[model samples]
Target: MTVTRFAPSPTGYLHVGNLRSALFNWLIARKAGGTFILRLDDTDPERSKEEYVDGIREDLEWLGLTWDREERQSARLDRYADAADQLREMGRFYEAWETPTELDLKRKKLLNMGRPPVYDRAALALSDDEKAALRRNRGTGVWRFKLDQERIEWTDGILGDVSIDAASVSDPVLIRQDGQVLYTLASVVDDTDMGVTDVVRGADHVTNTATQVQMIRALGGHVPDFAHHSLLTGPTGEALSKRLGTLALRDLRARGIEPMAILSLMARIGSADPVELRGSHDELIEGFDISRFGSAPTKFDVEDLVPITASVVHGLDALDVDEALSRAGVPDRLRKPYWSVVRGNTATRAEAGAWWPVFSGHATPEIAEEDREFVVKAFEMLGDPPYADDAWSDWTNAVKAETGRKGRGLFMPLRLAVTGQARGPEMADVMPLLQKKPSFD
Candidate 1:
């Protein structure tokens, strides 16, 4: 069975980009009857927080991306240590003693010679005593994985037929000088030990996947099939990385973007499929096909979500929003009809509150300067008491005959004067719910 995991660092809340990565892995697992693991790459304990861990869980739960198992890198320090020792024993891990300034100078020297600024691996030349002497001077050396100088290739699920020259890439540091096991080493150990069989992540991690693929084999673990999905951009194709902080799932939730709307759009935004609002998580999983996605950065527009949200709201059962209508002062007799009337006018459930006051208690009329006379005539025609379902049509038609008005000029003033807006649920439906008759006064 295919197994996948979404490994996120608990340093911050999740954004839409993060959602795409998480959902891709989740859909693969769900579609294959496999396990979905939530691995927290919280190796840097200094920056990771419990609140962020909670936030990550909250965001995933909000999106319905439930995980079967959760693994934290902080809890697996000994596992990483053992892997590091095994690599050192196999001559695949080596100590490197180079300060940032020294490495920068080496890079500049290599660039001056019209060469690639890859690591020269000078520390590999040092003998044991020389290394001890250097370590004694610099406290401790960082651990770097010694990559085989060859081409690394894998058939990526999305990008397909990927190859990288290891010699051109600098050896990744696996363990920092301060004894912190970096992501490069910790991820390999966890993914291998946890039986992660399929890896789906952002395009930015394609090079990282090549390095991890080698590490996994070095540790005698099966190499999982990998896919690198394209990154996201703004609606106009501007880089979205700078603005993702503001687009956190929590922020979007606060902005009233429904979870299903977000899930539906994310499941298809970069794919060949068009973005269609789905009714449930099962629908998203049933239709998910990673092969349909492309490597081009997909353009995402937050405003486009408005209509999808309206669509979601339009398909809800009266029971789904029964309590909300109760809280908003809709009478038991009026809740069903009230929801039917307002759902189309609303892009989100929050907008339902705006429609309540138009009928339940009070509404301020919005008559334009030129149409005030027409509105006054219409208001007087709407006499108090014994109003029916056809009261708006009856009053408007009578006013239309009396004032020689028709079309928008015939209807807009009446709509604005009564509901305080030019558009809403059919005024016929809005009229019966009105506890008080509207007037120009």
Candidate 2:
């Protein structure tokens, strides 16, 4: 069966860039009706944390990408050791006795000579007797894969056929002298062992593919097809990183960002004309298109999120939104207050009353006070009766006469008070809920 995997190192929170790679891999697996695997590359014991590993799984689940199998590199050390031994027996790998300082000097010399500073064949000339002597002396040396000095080529699904000069590439260290497997070897071994057919990840790993392909070939394992998707970029055209202030999935979730909103944002991140996707996760999965991926990097703009946020707020079922607010620790009475404040500022309301007082402490004093007076007088004129056609007309005229404010000024503040935002649906659609005797305090 065709298989794909998202193997992220559990070193930090899941950022947008990592989420995009996972999303793309998920799309490929689903589109092909194949298995999707989730692997944690937790080989670095110091950096990888159980919390981060659990978080990655949660993030993937939130994005609605389910994996068929899960694996951890830390749990499969013996497998990698076996692969290292196999390569050693095939004469495709060797132990290098060069100290760190000596290797650095060699690399510096090569760079000075205008040549790529790689661990060339000079390290491979150690005799069996010399190897034994070094081992006997308790000398610590890394196991390096001896790359074949011929051209290595592969056809990338997205980038097309690409070739690299094997001579220019270094003999990569498979196992560090400390006996820890490096990323390249651990990744390839796991990919092959898991029967992964395609390798889909971010372009940041593009250069590493060459080295991984070489390792796979050395071990007589089938190298999977690759598709290097572009990275998610910030507005400044730089790749998205934590340093750039890209929010983490956990942070976004804490800020009340819906899982669908996050996924919708991720789905449209790299599109030429980014558009939000609505509906259930399954519906999104059915309609996902890899071809829609833009060649240029996607910018993580907060402005790009406004439309989706509005849609989420507007389409939210009243009961669901109320429940969500309640679960979010918003008081039952305060739910409508918050909703009203959000809706009033964005929508056109008949009049605003108690809603105005809620925004009195807000930074926009003039707007808040104006909306408060409107609601008070509108309710006063309505006289506690259920608002009807006549009541609506009376309330409108009363507000115009009493407040002497009209159009945007009369309506905007009320909307702002209810929604706590200045822009959203009109007040006419927003007032009915407040008229039903919702309490803010």
Candidate 3:
């Protein structure tokens, strides 16, 4: 059976970048009829908060990304400690004492000589007496995983064949001097222990995956299949890292982007398939193929979600928007009628409120300066609202005859005069819903 996990740190709200990983892993697991784990990498108790954990769960629930079980790294600290001891016994983990200043100077010197700034393993040469003295002066030393100097290669699910020279990369720090286990160590331990079969994450983690492959082998564990999907960029191909605050899942939800619209776009934005709005998660799951995705940075624009959202809103059942319609002061009798009349015009369910005021005669008309007189004349010929079902046709016919206007010239101005907008549901459908007469006075 296949197993996958999405490990997110509850330090902040889940953003779009985080969503991609969660979605990919979820699809892979569900598609295989396997288990999906929601692992919280809350090793850093200082930054991680309970509120953020609740927020993460809420966001995933909103997106319909349900997980089978949840795991917290904080609860598995002993497992990480055991793995650290195992690596130490095998001579694969060593203590390193170097301040930030000393490491920066070493890196600068290496770059000046046209060499990679890999760690020189100076700690390996220190004898017991010297190591004791350094530890006494520097406090607790950070634990680093000593990588074997060789080429590490794997066939990535998305990026195809990959290779990295272990000698050129610095040995990863797995445990801090403050006695906190970092993600690098905790993730490997959890993945191995939980029987995870696949790992999917962002393209930025390709190097991390290369190192982790070695770590998994060092611990006598089976390496899962790894894939690195492309990162998202702004509309014009700019980095989205700086503007992530506005791209958070909560922000997008507040902006009225439907869950299906977001999921539909995200599931295929970087893939070979064209993005098509899916009405249900089942449809999205049925169509998902991880192999179809490319490695290039995918361009994402918030504006692209508008049309999709409009389509989603257009197809929404009355029950789906019941609360929103009720809040808009739409009475029980007019809820279905009002939704039907304005559903096409609305890009979001919240936008249905704008039409209630228009229908109830509370909206001010938006006639242009040149068209104001024409609108006043039309209102005179049409009289007050409380219109009949055919009132729009009867009134438009009267105005068209008096002004020698037909087609857009006559209909466009009247729509603006009555609805306060140039476009809306057919005036015929809107006429009977009007509870009060529209007046330009």
Which candidate ranks first by lDDT, i.e. highest? 3
lDDT of 1 by residue, 13-121 (tens): 9998888889999999999999999999999979999999999999999888999999888999998999999999999999999999999999999999999999999
Q: Which predicted model would earn the best TM-score?
A: 3
True-vs-predicted CA distance for residue 365, candidate 2, Å? 8.8
Which 10-residue window in model 2 sums to the lowest lDDT? Answer: 345-354
Q: By lDDT, is 2 or 3 better?
A: 3
Clash count per candidate: 0, 29, 0
Question: Which is superior by TM-score, 2 or 3?
Answer: 3
Per residue, candidate 2 scores C-alpha lDDT tens digits across 1-441 of 778898899998887667777877777788788999998999998899999999998887876789988989999999998998899899888888788788899999999999889776675777888888988885778888888888888987666777888788888888888888888999989888888898877777776888889888777788998877777667787655744334787766555566677678776666553566567766567767665664556567654554565566555543555544554444555555556545423211111222343322322323355356566665455554234535434566677788787887665554454455565444454454333432232
Best-to-worst ranking by lDDT: 3, 1, 2
State each model's CA lDDT, in order.
0.88, 0.70, 0.92
Query: Alpha carbon lDDT of residue 22, candidate 1?
Result: 96
**In candidate 1, which residue pairs clash?**
none
User: Model 2 reaches what TM-score against the true structure?
Assistant: 0.81
